[model samples]
Target: MLTRAEDGLENLWDSRRAAGMSEPEKLLCRSNLLGSDKRITNYGGGNTSAKVMETDPLTGAQVEVLWVKGSGGDVGSIRMDGFATLYMDKLRALKGVYRGPEHEDEMVGYLPHCTFNLNPRAASIDTPLHAYVPHRHVDHMHPDAIIAIAASRDSRALTAEIFGDEIGWLPWKRPGYELGLWLEQFCRDNPEAKGVVLESHGLFTWADDAGDCYALTLDVINRAMAWFGQKTHGTEAFGGPVRTSLEPRARAAVAARLMPAIRGFVSGGQHMVGHFTDAPEVLEFVNARDMARLAALGTSCPDHFLRTKIRPLVVDFDPAAPDVDAVLGGLKASVEAYRDDYAAYYGRCRRAVSPPMRDPNAVVYLVPGVGMITFARDKATARISGEFYVNAINVMRGADAVSEYRGLPEQEAFDIEYWLLEEAKLQRMPKPKSLAGRVALVTGGAGGIGAATAERLLREGACVVLADIDGDAVAEVGKGLAAGHSADVVRTVTMDVTDEDAVAAAFDRAAVAFGGIDILVSNAGIASSAPVEETTLAMWNRNMDILSTGYFIASREAFRLLQRQGMGGAVVFVGSKNALAASPNAAAYCTAKASELHLARCLALEGAEKGIRVNVVNPDAVLRGSRIWSGEWLDQRASTYGTDKEGLEEMYRNRSMLKRSVFPEDIAEAIYFLASDLSAKSTGNIINVDAGNKDAFTR
Candidate 1:
């Protein structure tokens, strides 16, 4: 049974309440409690509320208030301030005047006016529904278990039979003032009902106390699940896909062909990354007996439509195509047709006064035998939407196990997708940061400077590929970045840049993961300090191979990929101060950096024709966070300089005109400027990031 975590609930509220904490604290606690359970909600999926008493600023008297979860806050991690406080009297008054026909828009607009504070965070669109429900605490969620029961064709009959009139049933009503008013009256009439099932939207359970409300929600879903389990015979209907496997190499090649083509078509030729998945669960759903019909249904919930879209687009694929380019061309045509069909679907349902329609690009793409690909402007969005669809597939399976899976009607899906209240939420979102649609690749990305550059690119909204020789470290770093950004944004490749074959394959992986690469930061290198007499041929070759040869390999591959893309691109090489001013006992390092700098200049000359910019960033004495400056290396370097590590670092810092040490972030900033369009007019230029080292200045 789905039970409440009440072990310390009262103690938490009592302790926090003693410190002038309000009811929002209690509400947020319950919100977090429910949201922590993915079976209840995931990410920012659900909202919650509590009615409390607060002093009215104007009247200087205690008044009833409705504290509902607000925008930009996830219930899973909500704070006390995350709930927007509104006067219950004003909200209740809205129900008296709200008329039919898109009153949801006016209700949303009026919510801010009814706020206790003059300038309050915008309340969620469901505030009216919370206001109308005469309960102290209200919990709303789109639980997969409950959805399986609620979204079935026989939902009403099943709900009535299971709950025995203990719950109210509301047919799909497009969530607005109309539904809010109707739901309020329905609940008042059915005083004994503890919860209400909104056909396909979600479940609403309420009680006089927060714990009771949360417990009520869990109890209702558990009962529905029990009934569903008994009816379904232990869920054997939704089995894994027909067992068929493709060799990894061949599967990768198919993705490489179709990813970029679909990206180009979806973005109208703009740059974007294609995130591909063929996980076991996804394969099972795509290869199900009724794949087409199952995939054509709407999203698991109305909230999901904003992310996953109404339905995924299913297309045919030929993994064994002899000509890759021909297959790409065919996929492009198919995507165009999908776009046309989306536009037609829009035309059929749109009202004259609807906001300008959204882009008709498909969010999720299903290819029989190949796998699933979800398209988004950025990797984070693509990953989130992909996750929602994966959940949807599982939910659909569960629903099918019990009964026929039925989602909202086609017109209702359109209504929610373009609803003005939801549109307002998007309107309030911050503008996209620069480099939003671009994709970047960083070599030695697991290291300090390279990792910093990758993080910077991700913050600027670019999908990033972190390529490093240390596969394990780079994958771990990518995972951390993906947790904050999108899963597809940071892809890792274990590559020895000197290996031409590995370089080529890494580029193919990037193409498959994110369509194509637009910017390449060649920053992978190791530090070697030794007397010229003591430097061995092996040491010299090692530095030369990874430094100069690696730059050549990565740059060559980037150029080929960008040239084929026919889009302007950039290549940035991370050189060193040794290239500009020779350092003692650094013969191999100096010689290789000089060669890499000159190589960048040569690439700039060739790449200029194709609108590709090439540049180099030369940084000096960047000891902090550098793997090169750790443990024995630091001790060795300090001994070579006849001082302790700290003293040596200070000496290097004071040697510069700025009297400060350079950081990896300093070099990363210079690289970003050169790689982005801000440096469009400049190419083949060396940007120095040595904190004003006179000798390292480009001359």
Candidate 2:
């Protein structure tokens, strides 16, 4: 049975209000409450609204306003500003001149003009639908149980049987002003009805109060689930579990061989990242006897058209395939065939007014025995698309278990695939970053320099693997990055860089996670300070193990993976300014850095043949968050400078030509430039991120 979060509704509202919740905040809370439950909505799906009273600037009087969730705001963590307040009367007046269908653009344009507040947030495309409803509160969500019935061939009859006359049904209509008007009129006619179901779209439940509306929505969904359970006699979705002969290691090996081939075919010269998954559920579903036929029907809902397209590409696989090359060839052929079929489908149903055709590549590629591959311009988008397919697979199985699986016709699918609103949103997005489809690995990722570099790479649209000996700290760092991007973009692995076995395992995990790596940041190191006479053997070994030998191990693994993939890549070693400008008590420290710098140059000379570029970033005195500048080291540096800790920090900042303190982020930016294609032709070079320390300049 599906879980419902109706407990403590009144208490939650009271607590939120006492904590100073505005109308929008309350609405956001409700939206998040619904969105938090995956069964109710997935990713950015679903929207909510509340009728609020706001001051009219012109008349200085209170006015009724509709505060609704805005586009691109995930309902789970929506903020107060996430809502766009619109004048209800102005939106209602728009229906008089509504020119039937093909008004998606016109309607979208009109909604913004009707905003009560001068703030120009784009309300959801379903704003008109919410405005037309008479209730003080309204919600629309795509719940799995409800959609399973709605997407079935018998949706209308089944819905009627379940709800009787408590709810009304609207035939599938493209969301526009006209449909909103029809929904308003339908609600007026059926005043006794609790809500309405948009056939093959979603559910709308409303009440004068927010809590009641939410409760009603849950009650209705619970009824649907109960009915489905009785009909299916409690059989689990996908029938029975099907075990795979290949274990995890073998599955990853197959994925490693097939990922590049699939990416090569789908990318068509443009960059694309491929993500593989062999979760227990995925393995069972893909291995089912009739997997291909079942998945070929269509997406679980029209909302998925932009992401997963109408259907997934199901690649035929034989577990007994003789070699990796054979499997790769099969994967390549399947992708090419999918592209051809997609072109044909588009040709048959495209409208003259349709937007330019998107790349004819399938977002989802399913390998029956191995697993599934999801592709997109970036790792985050690829993972989101993959998640949608996972949910759809479940819904499809449920629909089959209860009734027959049916989806929208080809023309209907084309309509949503080319929807104007979706296109407009895409146009407004910033262009993909230079490293959009690339994957990066950073050592010392739990600390200052490594974490900052990882964040910079994430912003540039590269999937990152953060490796550090601090396992828990790196996990927390990964969590923070995941919040801003997709979880697939940042992976954390705990490793002592000196361990060859650990380094190999981390690289292997990264390859399986994001197909392969494109950039390597060898930033992991320890700092030691002592005169040649006072330097201890233990201190010397520690510095060399983590600094010189550690860098060699990580760089070698990176080279191995890039060689295996036969793709050109970049590697940046994080050497120190001390490598060039030695300080009097830094014997072991300076020697290890100097050696590492040359190591990078050596790799560059050899790697150039295979299209790999190697470089070094030398940073000086980045002490704010540096894990290296602490404990007795701080006191020793202060004493050497004839001052306290704070004065010594100031002395270092003034010593630089820029007369400013260098930050870890400064180093990250330099690393980013070298890691990206912007430095494609430049290698065997050193970039200084030391706020202009003249003594450290290579020239």
Candidate 3:
């Protein structure tokens, strides 16, 4: 008796596509189709399952196997291996042993015993909810439209009004064994019901057919959306807008300043990457009159609360009289107050056996007129946190428009937040890489050494911003790196190192893109090989403009941003062996390189107090993969050394103490050491990556 709505949700299921699919494959297809839309569920926020008859590995007898999305898996991107297989009989038998809600945490340990075919994928905590549904297929989703109704003050009445007897409703209870049983009982009572809405939680739908189950989930959400649309039509959302939004450029400028300041305060233990959004929904909610009241109440859904924290820190900034500097000055105090409030919440809610308090810092920050900013240990998490807050905002908008919106009770939220199972999940997460939360900005990033350094940093879990004069080349390199590592960690900007404004803008972009920069690799340079008699003013100026002046500008901008962040930073200058060896017929290049080396020493001395370390990596004859070697500089150096272009590399190698050919990757390795914590205590020093060049050795 289920009817599909004319609008709101699309039926993406291709019967042709599912024609040859097995039951497990059909379940996966349905899960993916449902998860593909943000309107259906946020990332990693929903679970889907199917009970299929599979032959037992040992007995060769067919049994009902429950295939469900495994722990920490996103249905949209899940593969066959991501589904945990368990015996349905064993799952049902768990009901007899389950004592009560107080002992629900122990039930998670019993899941592994119910494993069918020894599937290695760990079953998620929501397994019982799907197992107890009493249907061949089940879907549990956190669609915004459905959650809007679930989180409303009259959630039960609203559910009845919208779907009548087709869908049932359950009161708020933390998701676990008891709630799964509650779902089973609800089904047993309402035999005509197709699904049920869990108050302040999400929607659960079931069907004997996978296609019908998928369609029912969409149909239920669509009905809710349609009903809310009609009931709340023409109503003001979140009590309407109280403030005007700043222009796009102005908003970005404010975010560039505010993000780094906030990052400095919260990143005391580890660096945090940031994500900023000025989407229409975020702007509408932040600028609304009831923003403070609604945000204070917190998010209703446990998934939303978990990612965005109990509540966001509302930044004190008025768009009417925008003064970003004033906001920046008071940022530390604001952040500290939020931490103190969070600590007090923990104190009031902590149980005798509760896990120790986590990072007291706020994850979401709301600035009226600008937008929302979220920070986490890494870029993806930060971005995902922002998305979850947007979902919360949508829920509030709908719930407040029709009926009063309700957040979970404080004790209930506290129990879920500090639950032992949640703590164990956190403990089981893999240890983060050394450079996990660090962000780096590399000049000349399109070049071989620059790209290699970016790769090295990214491999160790650092976000990298590639800046270079060649826009196309830098973008191409950024694209390739983004493909390897995620696009979240790689950003590219076209920059002229000698242009003061361009240099500052690039750093600001870096701040807005990934919070702020922690490491600066000053590698932009030019080479000119002319005898003293032939060295014109133009040639000398060109070398100095790029090598000396450019390095100074880039470093100065990096220092300014690092100071703004209040976090210590690293500056690694890509100098040359010629700076010390006094190469013939290259006076201009040698002089510029030496200037760069001396500048690093001065910066090292000045920045030591602030924990910013500056050092130099000197490479002699980096002929392979070097843009300098690809140009006229190679022919000029070969002519000077009385050798052909092909033999020039060999001549330089023979001149070195080790007689080994140097490549860009070799130089990159030295730069990485100097830029990372490996050289934390060794500043104002020079590393000769010239394959053992005695002439370039520092005494």
Candidate 4:
């Protein structure tokens, strides 16, 4: 493990500095690898930089440039532009700080001009410190293993005992101008201090040669692990009698508790992918002893606190027990105290703008063996915290043996935890609901899938104008939906998505209906499966015209309307998973879907400049009861599955890992989530409804 870790670190570090590497490509690659695992860094947690030689425009000489990670990028998914370039000489020049008139303002102007794009990206507030690192390839990470050891009792003593004098440990320091000065001098003083361990926080390693820098990180993790393992022994803190299962009743109860917040957050427009796990780890944390002892005990490496808040809600054992209410009440009360404390800490250290309100997402369970629980806007952060908790608990056990785990000082941890610059780094893709309060002219509203998607958006507070080629039939369908909600909530339009004039009329009617356009769900058309050779031109155009073009015309009008409104909107082309995973007789059907897919992407980028959000939903096989299944179709599916009607229904749907079929409502729910603020920062993203078919989909 040590060797593998060391090798990976070395390769990543040295690859950037390698002569063969393209600078922009190396910057993005570095960010991608560092962003992949929370064990390495939390959400937007780490920064990577490369010192490259560039020509001075006026001086006509070679100079060093520092391309550091940019703000608003998730390292896991940053692109080439995510690296902001700074003139190394300018950064170095700033080191000679003098209180003068043009000092700060001059710095800001130079800061932007130094970028690869002349555009300004928020610089890491720690720019001075990163710029000053002697190494060309420098990385900073808040690794769990290191932090666990750092937080333990006797951490400083244990660190000294483990590393001898080669390691330099710094007391927690405020991480901006002063910290930058301290780090520069410390590196100067301890020329042999291979790695710097910031007490209670993280580690910093650099390499004049990137490979050496990366190697030291692994070496540090290994050393920290060894010290931690020796510190805690024979305590089966994580391993236990094993939880047979979570309370089945608890699922519904917890779901109930989580629902309101989810609903309020989504505001009833988008459906939440919720239902929590009392997974063994979650249960273990909940039932552990001394849970909720202090909120900090189980926090996700401090950085995560920026998004999911700082601590989780630690429910008690026998969570259903009435007494649990009293405990929960206390937890809520503690929230104010935590918020007040964090805000106060911000005020004490902050010299600039105020920070966002403080709240924690991690909570320790009171049960001796119970673990912790965390919540996130999406499944990703929750999973990050879960992994962090597992590794942390191990570190905690280790610390118990070596000495108590020492963590960052509360305020310093809070500063990093609530660091506004870091928090603001998350690139929030504009959520697509810019169409909310708008009218959409869906081409195939009478159809199951189109109707389902329309329902999803209507629930999102958008006014929908349901249109279909089968005008009369769709009018009736829209009438039915309107009755269920409000007649005005849905207006029926009789226009074929395939007909140009009709498509225009429908848009006109929508504009008349809703007074403006906000969101668009362009789902309309038919599909006929046939072999490529057997497919006729006529068959291809029929499907392409009625389905893909109909969607196009509707989308085209929606795009125009969205443009006129001067606000962004989300327009989801109902694409099929067949586009990615081909089927036997889907050649022509496939091409049209592929065309719409590309169209959505092109528009996503183009509309991005317009504040418009565009994306496509490629749902796998959808077998819902709306309009897709006529009596004959149902009978055929039932007979093919060798089951009775009910069994065939379940068989058709319950084949996914989640053991559920792709329902029209499910598609609607997923689309609603994507169209709302939940996916505000998620333009150009495709969501697959396929449940774990390895060939199924992509993120």
What C-alpha lDDT does candidate 3 achieve relative to the native structure? 0.93
RMSD of each: 4.4, 4.2, 1.7, 17.2
Off by over 4 Å in 1: 1-22, 57-60, 102-104, 117-119, 234-257, 268-276, 318-327, 401-403, 470-494, 500-516, 529-534, 560-567, 580-585, 609-611, 629-661, 691-699
The best candidate in terms of lDDT: 3
Q: Per-residue alpha-carbon lDDT of model 2 for 368-417, expressed as tens digits?
A: 66788898887767787887777677667767886787777789888888
Query: What lDDT would each prediction earn against the true structure?
Result: 0.79, 0.81, 0.93, 0.60
How well is each residue in 138-246 modelled by candidate 1, as lDDT tens digits?
9888777777767888878877888888987888877677777877898889998888888877889899987678777777767766665677764554554553535
TM-score of the candidate numbered 3? Answer: 0.98
Candidate 4 C-alpha error for residue 275, in Å: 7.2
Per-residue error (Å), model 1, residue 358:
2.3
lDDT of 4: 0.60
Model 3 lDDT at residue 348: 96
Over the stretch 392-492, how does candidate 4's per-residue lDDT look in tens digits? Answer: 55445455445655444555556565555445544344464433444455666788877877777666556677887777888888877877667656788
lDDT-best of 3 and 4:
3
Candidate 4: list runs displaced more than 4 Å: 1-19, 23-31, 57-59, 98-110, 116-120, 238-282, 294-301, 308-310, 319-401, 406-699
Candidate order (lDDT): 3, 2, 1, 4
